[model samples]
Target: MQALGFEVLWKGKNFARLMGGLWVALRISLIAVGISLVAGVLMGALMTRKNPVVKALTRLYLETVRIMPQMVLLFLAFFGTTRWFGWNLSGETASVIVFALWGTAEMGDLVRGALESIPRHQYESAAALGLDGKQSFLYVILPQTLRRLLPQVINLVTRMIKTTSLVLMIGVVEMLKVAQQIIEANRMKVPNAAFGVYLTVLVLYFLACWPVSLLAKALEKRWS
Candidate 1:
């Protein structure tokens, strides 16, 4: 235990770097989640429309995003897009863009699922009350759909947070990256630093995710 690099993390400089990296992860996830929620809701609503062409296009977009691995997406954003398109993007900016794209696709599917799960009777009742399409959706549909959507959104957020570790692959220096750096720096002296550093990172991820999980459960109980 003492042979591990736990002491490195306790050092002020490393701890500060760890916290800074964690904040980077948090910032990326929060912004991505926000952008994705709005885009997803609009796209998901469009997906349910009567136009076959629009539906097909939307489905294709969703499937393409779903099928691609996130690491591949990040690489494409960081390397392919920048080189091929002549777009200059910083590592953090690229990470946010890729994650936002991924989150939007996922959230759109969740929105579509929630909207579809709402019984037809609810819509019928709204129509019977002389409610127009927009009114019906705003008053009768959105509130109920929100109950289901919130938990799923929270789950997506946790996933995005966890996957932020992948940003390290592109040299983003996020939490896991900082941990790896510390381990590498101390590997010879501590001998067992790799295991301790990773264990600490795992604990940090758990700490980050647990609250969102608890929030989802609480929302479920409250809304159910």
Candidate 2:
């Protein structure tokens, strides 16, 4: 076995460049998650409405996102439609846009589930306490929705972090891309370096994602 080189990962200008790419990925994920949360909440609220048109539209949106692979969505956003619109969008922008759109659909569904899980009597009780629909939701329903929503949202964030790896395929030089570069560079000297590099990348991903998973578990335990 090759000596495990902790120092290799930490030393020099290359490490800084690798981390810079990671920051780009993190930034994209953060913006995507934020946009998705707002879009999801609004969509979830609309889903709760009694309007058939709204329900049908929301269902169609959710189903479309569900049926499509994320890579396909990325391709469609980045490559398929830009020429038709005469709009110039970069790889990172396209990635964020696709992830936000995808995440909104997912988060909206998650929010709907959490909101619906609340006992109907909670709304009734809020109404009985002289709270109007808006007030009731703002003060009562929203709080409970948040309680349930937090764990799921945390889980989604971790998923988002992992999913960002896919963006490398479209030429975004994130962590995976950096690892691929390293593997290629080392492959001549160390024939099995690709395996080692990939193993390291896997561990890095686990390091990044595990805390979010743990946080979700803790929140679930605390709230449930």
Candidate 3:
């Protein structure tokens, strides 16, 4: 048992290589999350507007992203575009783009819900207090909407982080892909390496996600 641990953990810097792959995953997820937050908030805000054209456009985006699978989107971005448009996108770039699109749709919906959930009286109260549309949204409406959105947004962050594993399908060489490589390389000698390697990957993902989950719960409790 101890020998198996040594083989998996210490053999040829396998752990270090895995950590590198994890870094790749983390970097992609973070970039995607940042883009999604900015774009999603704007999309969501537009979705709540009374303008028919804006609502229709945002709705189409939301539904398209909601209906498409992330894997398919990744393939389309990475492989299809190269064939059709001559734009050769890297796997990491494709993964980030796909995730940002998915996250935007999700975050936009959450934001829309949060914004709409604000009571009509709040708007009336803001108007009574001499607050114009901009002032009411900035000072009165946005804060409450953000408070409502916080937990769900954090949850989406965790989801995006986990979903980054799918980038492996497109040859992104993230943690899971690294794990598979390690297992294949050691299949001859360290027969039990798969268990250890995959278990380590699992623990890594759990560690990354658990704190986000806790933060979400804490925000929910504090805001409730």
Candidate whose TM-score is highest? 1
Number of residue pairs clashing in candidate 1, backbone atoms closer than 3 angstroms, sequence gap of 3 or more or interchain: 0
Q: Of the candidates numbered 2 and 3, which has the greater lDDT value? A: 3
Local distance difference test scores for all models: 0.87, 0.82, 0.89
lDDT of 3 by residue, 120-159 (tens): 9999999999999999989999889989888789889998
Task: For model 3, name the residue pairs that clash.
Answer: none
Better of 1 and 2 by lDDT: 1
lDDT tens digits by residue: candidate 1, 120-144: 9999999999999999998988889
lDDT-sorted candidate list, best first: 3, 1, 2
TM-score of each: 0.94, 0.90, 0.93
lDDT of 2 at 48: 82
User: Candidate 2: where are CA atoms >4 Å away?
Assistant: 1-12, 217-224
**Candidate 1: how large is its RMSD?**
1.5
- What is the C-alpha lDDT profile of model 2 across 1-224, one tens digit per residue? 46443334543465676677677788888899899999998888888888999999999999998799989988888887686786678889999998998899989998888889999999999999999999998889988998878877888888898899889877889988887776666656565666666677777778777877787788778878
Candidate 2 residue pairs in backbone clash: none
